[model samples]
Target: MKKFLSLILALTMLLSLVAVSANAEDITLDVIIAQYGPNTQEWFLGKGMDGSNFVEKFEAANPGIKLNLEVVSWNDLYTVVSTRISNNNAPDILNIDVFADYANEGLLMPVQDYCPEELYQDFFPSFIDQSVIDGTVWAVPDLASARALFYNVDLLQEAGVEKVPETWAELEDASQAILDAFGGEVYPWGIDMTTDEGQAAFAYYTWGNNGGFVDENGEWVLNSDANVEAIEYAIGLVNKGFTNPNPATQTRYDLQDMFAAGKLAMIIAPNQLPTYVTDKEGNVNLATAGLPHNEGATSSSVGVMDRIMAFKDDAAPDQAARNEAIGKFLTFFYDPENYVGWVSMEGFLPAVNSAVGALVEADPSFQAWLDVLGGAKFYPTTKAEWNDVKQGVIDVEQQALTGGNVKELLDALQAKIAGK
Candidate 1:
């Protein structure tokens, strides 16, 4: 009788296993992506906003799983994501750049828990280093862009400038000559000292000056002499009528528009300017160089990244399956042939060495832009207080640009960030 009871219990367990496996045959992954507007190319060939047709192939290869994608703008991303997270209804995957903050809040799963070590090794070492916070991989890099000096060749020539400026003094001289040559009819430079680009531009200038927001010991140095000098120099350009006079009211897009209209000689922007500045006539005589730095200082550009991250829901019944699907999708996404197209279409530098080789062979024009990535410095976005600090910095910068004292503004900002 005891043996008979044991046999029945074993049969029940086997039946339950079969039922669970059958249930796992059908899976759906909810995803949220940031829309880059119409100009943004979709690397994946798919029916919906995810843009890659890879979804169909993925589904065809794995019949049980489906990817449901929703597109959100960068302006709405945090708000929507936060609301979802607060409601305990976050998506399976998100394409975003704020993983560090989310990771700090315990809202993310370390990719290393799901992705293979070999897969992680395929990423650029620096990028991989950046994605890890508190010793865990929070996000996977999708694309990266480094800031560079984009100059209108024809405009520079018209201003009697023989070459693009390589130092702060040369930049000042070039701007003065351009303004004088054009009789102040056109802005000589388009320094975007607005809410959108101010912090980034400031970082580029500070980094180019061989200074940054923090020191090697992670101290807040917002009011460092180099930073103060850089900010003041930018403001001086506006006061001198070389940059857009009302930069506080303008945005980076507005600056780019002004540049595209041939009304500005130089603008410091990400490598995407080439894609943004072209007209129906084909392309402009755009020339690229590293951002100008203080004399005798090492030059650096700011690097921006977009990442794809997977989430974990401990309460979900199909958690393991979902994670497995995510691993598979990431592996598929990073394959050289697919990633190379993504790099070319998305207008970002390749995150892996293989993609870099493929991209160079496919598009040689990106060599200068690629060169800038070597000296790219990043804002300290890993800090839990990063978003708030960034907002504070932007506010202070806007104040400084609008006739407030740079030292006073930065001092206040430094105090606030330090307190945070």
Candidate 2:
């Protein structure tokens, strides 16, 4: 009887161990984050997960929840995702800059289904509104940024300009004077008219002139009179020899490089630029301000936000378990103490309004950039066909820089985007 009882106990122990192993195996949540290169992963995710990191903390807080991360560079992410879709395999979570395509295709799950109501409400409405379409909030924004006017302070002073340009007239005057002073040595402006940058520049100028891609009622106003005036003004600067010789060929990155080397006097770029300029020792005396507007127009910057979207998988045996893990991770990720590291790492404005308020108090230099976001605007991100529309806008803007008619191009673009 003793021998039989001992054998029974051993079998019971073995059964318990197998059950534990099965539970552990199902706890892991797989995630994929987009990157431009391997270095971008390093910068965003840090060296490795440990006691001091987001992954470790999240795992510790939610016992049995292990995060498995995959980093895909931007150049290859789409191809990889498409192949995985063909196989009916998708990561539980994915990072995307533009979520509309995935949302429209039914590839993403509405974050609201898993995230808490209060937490969802905590995000800035402007940022959150962009992620919603047809009543579904498709993605949760993780980081954000806004545009600013960056200038070489030393160069501005050298050109006999007293203060940073505050209006179209001021900017033109500053550009002409700076060109006359640094003729044949430096370009007065580092204009980026390539497809990658032309649309953003156009947005700022259009908004600065009190015009926009869409009006308050969300109507297409790309070819409004104000936008026309803004475009003409920008082209006039180039025609009058106040900007780079060829604006159409240079990308924003190329212009940033020139600006850092002190070869270009001014440009409207993202707020992250000051650090890059300082790191290169390119211009220690650089200054940032709101991009200049027309005399009677309100100044506005373009706000940019990126998201982390959780995808629903019907094939998973325990979909609820996956959703719970996602909710827990997002809760931990956006907590002020934890989110600050990611925001600071990427040089972006905080998407959380509370965090933004906290940072504005903590860092004085950040205030100017944050202040400009009060009236910031975003592109027509909710449109399912925005990708094609955006490409059209880029093409026309680049064509305009290379001598295409501004009015004709914008009118055609407006019609095309409106499906006319």
Candidate 3:
């Protein structure tokens, strides 16, 4: 009887160990984050020797959780994410731009269900509104960005321009003066007429000029008088020798590099450029100003936000468990302390309003960004129509700026986007 009892006890212990192992296995989760462009390697892998320490810290805090990260180039982010979704093999979490494309699709999970309402209210209304669609919050604003004018003070001084421009006419005058002063040795401005950056810049200028990309009924309105005038003004800058020769071939990076090297007097770029400029010890005299508006027009520029998305279908049998883990991670990431690290390191404005408090207390240089966010506006919302409209606008603007007829280009663009 004693031998039989001993055998029974051993078997019971073995069963309990097996059950524990199963529970541990069930707790592990797979998460994928997309990092693209020049910033990808930094964002995912971290900057210097502390490679993936953030990921390590996260995993250490959450027992039995495993994270799988893949670093993808920015060029392939959209394609890979889209293909995964179409193949019914999406990641547990994904990062998406704060445009209408991903939000319009029902691919992302509503974060509001997992996050607290108070937390949700902490973001700027415009920031929150962009992520909310069809009465559901599909994503959380991870980062927010605003456009500004970056000028080389030395160049401006060389041109004998006492102050940077605040209006369209002032910009033109400044440009012309710079042209006369430098005499082809330097370009007065370096504006990108490329597809992505140029379209965004053009939209802001046109909107500031009282034109917009879409009407109340969602029709394309790029051919409006205000837009035409804005495009003409942009082209006029080039004609007056205010812009670099052949801006159509210039990319955003190229323009920024030129401005940083003091080759260009002025450039329209994101507020984050200051961080990059400061890092390179390029020029301490660099100053950022709000984007100039059309004569007698209000100050307005295109604002963009980045968001974190999670798919419900991808969560599978462990949906609730995975959602809980993701919610915790997001909360931790957005926590005022941890969030500041990411934002400051990444050189992006914080999406959380509470983070503004941290920024003020920690880094005063970012105060200007907080002010910029107060009046920022996002791209118009449309389901699956963003890419089409964006491409159409770029095509038209490229043609118009490259000696093509502005009226005909705008007309064709409007018609093509409107399906006319």
Candidate 4:
């Protein structure tokens, strides 16, 4: 009897140990994020007490689940994410841009595997549509940004411009008057036409003129008459002394600083500028309006959105568990209350429809962004053609603005697209 009792006790102890091992395995997860530059990690986390508060809350709500965040410079992010994916060493969660090459490589897991269809149905269809590749939804939309006219209302009033321009002709006229009023002291308008941001700003002009990057068949259609006309209009602004002479040299932040200093009468930038334009003591008074279009044309801007992606790798132990953790974290992070904090604090538009309504109720200043969101359209996301398209637009626009022949530039662009 004593021997039998001892045997039973040992077997029970073995079972308890096995259970402990399984629970330990379930308590940890690895989440990686791409860091763009200096202090970018802080930006990702959020600002001040709000940021610290959220991090603590997230960890507490997810007890025993360890989150390991890695930060890499933008220059190194693509290489890092790619290498990890190639080796099947990808982290459980990662942040990626919508048009990145990884999406083209099919390295990401579809969000549909975890999220309910109805959860995403109410999101802006165009925004959600951009995430679909080969009929699989690879990521969840996080934040969105839209281009709008960032004008100094006080400066416009000083120049005797009674109202913001609603048409291209009026924009040109207002720009001329502002330039004349400010002389060499202030730039009438400043655009960063040399960078991707510049190209995006240029998209508005092309779209306003009834042009686009591709046709119904998805072939590049950049050299069309409407596109050339749009390019010409942008060049005209430069020639009329309405733009800063060396716009190609200015960074997006530099342009924003100039606007804040009242050195720029009008400019086109993302809806987030108000947060960056505070006064000497950190007060803010900047205002935003929609980008003007040609009369009888629809106005547009280059739209950018972010994605949270998961990677597939059979070697990663507990793949199912990690995916479950990610789904939970996203649900926590995207709660309407939490989302408002993230968007308002980070200067981004919310990804969920419910979050958008919550934000509008909380902050009236966001109304302009909400208004723009109602009409926003994304840039092309067909495939690897994005790099070629981006470079082509920049090259042609630079040539057209710098006294190069528009026709010759357009012809070359068409040839490049056809060759692609």
- Largest lDDT belongs to which candidate? 2
Clashes of each: 7, 0, 2, 0
For residue 170, model 1's alpha carbon misses the true position, in angstroms, by 1.4
Cα misplacement distance, residue 19 of candidate 4 (Å): 15
Query: How close to the true structure is residue 233 of candidate 2, measured as C-alpha lDDT?
Result: 84
Candidate ordering by lDDT (highest first) = 2, 1, 3, 4
User: Can you write out model 2's per-residue Cα lDDT over 237-334, one digit (the tens) per residue?
Assistant: 88888877777788887888889998889888888898777666775478787889999998878887788898878877677777888888788878
Write model 4 residue lDDT over 133-252, tens digit each, in one string.
677777777788887887887788888888788788989888877877888888877777766456675587888877877766767788888888888888888888888887666767
lDDT of 4 at 24: 78
**Per-prediction CA RMSD (Å):** 7.3, 5.4, 5.6, 6.4
Which portions of model 1 show Cα errors greater than 4 Å? 1-24, 37-52, 279-283
Residue 216 accuracy (lDDT) in model 2: 91
- Alpha-carbon deviation at 309 in model 1, angstroms: 1.6
Look at candidate 4 and tell me the lDDT of residue 131. 78
Q: Estimate, for each residue in 1-420, the C-alpha lDDT of model 3 and write its tens digit.
A: 999999999999999999987867545444555552355456545752155545566677776666665666566778888798788887777776743565566666678656766777776777777766666767778888888788888888978999889898888889889989988877887777786466776776787787877766756687988888888888877777778887677888887777777778888777788777765567747887778888888877567788877776753666677777777767766777667766776778888888887777777877877788767767765335667767777776788776888878888877776774
- Where model 2 places Cα greater than 4 Å from the true spot, the runs are 1-25, 36-40, 43-53
- Report the alpha-carbon TM-score of model 4 versus the true structure: 0.84
Stretches of model 4 off by over 4 angstroms after superposition: 1-24, 27-29, 34-56, 71-76, 79-88, 116-122, 216-218, 279-286
Q: List TM-scores for all candidates, in order.
A: 0.89, 0.87, 0.87, 0.84
Better candidate by TM-score, 3 or 4:
3
Q: After superposition, how far is residue 262 of candidate 1 from its true place, in Å?
A: 0.9
- In model 1, state the lDDT of residue 192: 65
Alpha-carbon local distance difference test for all models: 0.78, 0.79, 0.74, 0.72
